[model samples]
Target: MGQASFACDPAQTRGRRVAEEESAFRSCFQRDRDRIIHSSAFRRLKHKTQVFVEHEGDFYRTRLTHSIEVAQVARTISGALGLNTDLTEAVALAHDLGHTPFGHTGEDALNALMQPYGGFDHNAQTVRIVTELEKHYADFDGLNLTWDTLEGIAKHNGPVGDPVPYALAAYNALHDLELHSHAGAEAQVAALSDDVAYTNHDLHDGLRAGLFTEDQIAALPIIGAAYGEVDARYPGLEPYRRRHEALRRVFGAMVADLIDTSRDALAGSGCAGAQAIRDLGRPVIAFSDRLRGDLKEIRAFLFQRMYRAPSVMAQREKVTKVVEDLFPLYMSDPGLLPGRWQRDVAQAATDAALARFVADYIAGMTDRFALQEHARLTGTHVLGDLT
Candidate 1:
């Protein structure tokens, strides 16, 4: 499909921080997407857990799987809206690169530990990874992504206000991201697609984990109608088939709702171009009010039954201790960090700078690596492979 007037045009991109000859065979956004796929940080997402710990089950969504799903959903939404699917997919896939090993639990623990230094924000860490940490390139420290992609990465969730995140602030000072404005429509699509993918897939994972029953979730708003529709159409279906059919419908409803609602908004918004969309100061891509309310109920249900279940909480405590233990040890003995990371520690001019190096090293660890390191360093004969 031809892109809409308000779609981000690769030809008109704000350009990379470090200028490079344009690719003859691909758009800049496509190159950005390909770069993210090949990134070392992206590779580590394979073992980064989301709601379920990586060791608990192979079927549950790791950050890698979730990112791929979000990218898929974002591409569909972007295509339907005649937005730039490449940019959308790039933003979607790169969105979670900064997530710590054990997911939000680990991020939270690490943030608390680093509070004395500068604190941790996964979003900021994501920006850091793309802009600075990926040092493979000879021309620059990071992937050296275009300004458009950088803005999308930094502000996809929304605008940055006072006390902007340290990593982002540092980078933005070098190349301003227009921090107090909404990212373009493609980024907005990526952000909402994250919601759609997670809400739908988390329901699937929750059911598979037996954290909550199908009958229980069937009582929730949008899901109830979905279950009812599945029951009417496939009355005698096997339990597995019934659940799968109903949840697929739920997923369809979310994607459909997002596309339809955003299509209407775009038609009415009088946006002349992508820049106009950015200046609108509101997310044009979003679910309808009805679906938004339905999602709130679903999320609350998950928070109680899935996220905060006793078993999950117990695992959270243990993993939290892993981060807590890892940070200070690495901080006190910079020698403990791997040899490759030693150069950063030796050059540290302050305790805070050294702590940041430690944060960067620990934050990059995969779940299994973090667990193994914790066991080896702290003398806990635990799961070497959290499988």
Candidate 2:
């Protein structure tokens, strides 16, 4: 049997390592999970949008809930395969910490606004949050996470394009090498788990918000079948209750399929249970051809019915404008900012720092807070920038 370098302590999953007992606090992966939990960026996720705006309703999935759901799905798959559940959960939790107030609408606006400065990417900004932006301890700039967790977040997109400047170059380089060679199954699980959560949960949120009718939801083939399977599996629920039950059923199926497919692929590769498989440096998951096709079909159905709907797009437009206006006004003159950031603004000069400062500021706000800031600056309910 191969020796295991780390130990798992479920109770200490989110505890940090201090100077006194840095050797025994938690596993490297566990420390990564804990660091994410304690970071300011993670806390800000509570206010960010998921599929619906924060004000859309109290029950809509905020970025926090979305992160939690993704973590749950990722851990389920990872645990099923004897992978690192804590690591997967941590990565999933921190994945959206850099998301702006209004979800992707805000993200798009931030990208446009910050295009001149290295550009804005939630994934990139997530790295910045842990390694640079966050100010928790006196010794470091970011969270000072473990090499593996940092790599997972940095190369979450895999070897697609563009290189991330990781804090640990060796680990980063190793991960990059692994990607071209194959891809990390755990990272792939985390990525696809996100898709699974969004595919089913967003549809559920939309239906609950009155954005779509039962007939509309049931009309989509993949979604309908998933719902039917759930109903048959556990019947005798009221209509309102059925939607939530169906959502769980769909998510469960996605998780199950991902785990089974990943296991089969690993088995086929003749490296079913090896430490080498765990160190999958790349960002791809090797799924059987059948499961891949099914995932793609499910994604396509969601794109047609949920993501691209005119009603949703219209709201997204409104969300886009809110972020676009709020960012620049604060960037140009952060003296207008509240709390400690205003003090930091008084010390900085030049546009780069200002842009980053603004990015940090905007990224930290909730949907309501962003709106309020807009109202305070523009004197109108609509979003705007003051010079």
Candidate 3:
């Protein structure tokens, strides 16, 4: 029998066996772990933002660091709970593959530009990246990732609608929808792990940025208690080393608490095995009452000090303006798009196809590429060689 700790039914891969020649130390999940490590999207993370831009400070967190933290937290919790560490690490690593250059600001801009089209969502875009965008095999267009990984990416947020029917469903009745929605527990864990990673690490980054001080952070009881716990556990490390390790420990505690709380809550509710139980729709964090209260305070701290800080807000507004102005220009002059886009626009196909193509062209851009495109189309700013 297949390993049963994780959620995705192993049968779904249709016995498409992982080759035996692959590393003996690697389980199916480990193979997936390696696949994600080798992806180009994974590398682009170094250039992406977490909270502060990478160029802003030497100590600031970038998207790459953020992913590493998420993987670290997820692996810890999965190891504790006897879940598949490799799978959790893979999911966390690939989670933000679709995030744009300027962090959420960039994503927001793209979403507005593509709103008339199928609307932009980083999570949804991540699915597209693995399934269609990352051109690898000549026979298969994208990374031929297992359905488990796709499910984790697609339904990580919990249940939305019915699982889309898969191929050959009910004798062609479900032909149009070739894949089932992957609203499973593993997916939910991936989503929750992302929350755990950011909520804690963002605070750490803010502190590093001098946007908030440790005393300010310690004002929140949950964080304060978590910090104390770490200090008590690791008493002999150097002061600087202790503080850094303490932050990671705090993140771990939060994740562990949330996972335990969530698992118990779901189990007690008689919804343990039901697919819908895992897809919580909104950003649900399974924490205790006290922890929940403290986390809100933490979020408030970020909103006031980090997200709404004058420097960050100024950049956010600039991104909004660039995206807003440039989108109309592209729509008006479809010729400005790449040759493939030009032909598609000329054909005037169904709106869905048109929208998908527009999204594709827009989503594939690097930060500098988007900026240059904005400048070229709107003539508001001059282009530079330094992307």
Per-model CA lDDT versus the true structure: 0.91, 0.68, 0.64
Residue by residue across 1-387, what tens digits does model 2's lDDT show?
Answer: 222222223333333222323648666677678889888788878878876777767888888888898998888777777666777777788888778888888878887888776667777678668776788878766787755566567655564354432222323453333323322455666787888888777777777766667767676545588678767977877887787776666667667777777766655555533335444443335445665676687567667666777877887887777787777777766777878787667766778767877887887788888887777777776534422
Tens-digit per-residue lDDT, 1-387, candidate 3: 233333444433322222233346656666777777788888887767766644456576677788897887776665554445666677888888888767888778877766665567787677667766677766654465665665566656654344321211221251122234434555456667777778877877777767878767766767677567767887776865766776766776777687777656555545433244344333332577877777788788788999999978876787667667666666666677887557657776766456555666666565556667777666665323334
For this target, which candidate reaches the highest lDDT against the unseen true structure?
A: 1
In the range 304-339, model 1's lDDT, one tens digit per residue, is: 999999988988988999999999898889999989
Task: Count clashing residue pairs in model 3.
Answer: 4
- Residues forming the 10-long window of minimal summed lDDT in candidate 3: 163-172
User: Candidate 3: lDDT of 386?
Assistant: 31
- Which regions of candidate 3 are displaced past 4 Å? 1-28, 161-182, 226-246, 262-285, 334-352, 372-387
Clashing pairs in 1: none
True-structure lDDT of candidate 1: 0.91
lDDT of candidate 2? 0.68
Clashes of each: 0, 2, 4
For every candidate in turn, the CA RMSD to the true structure comes to 1.2, 4.9, 5.4
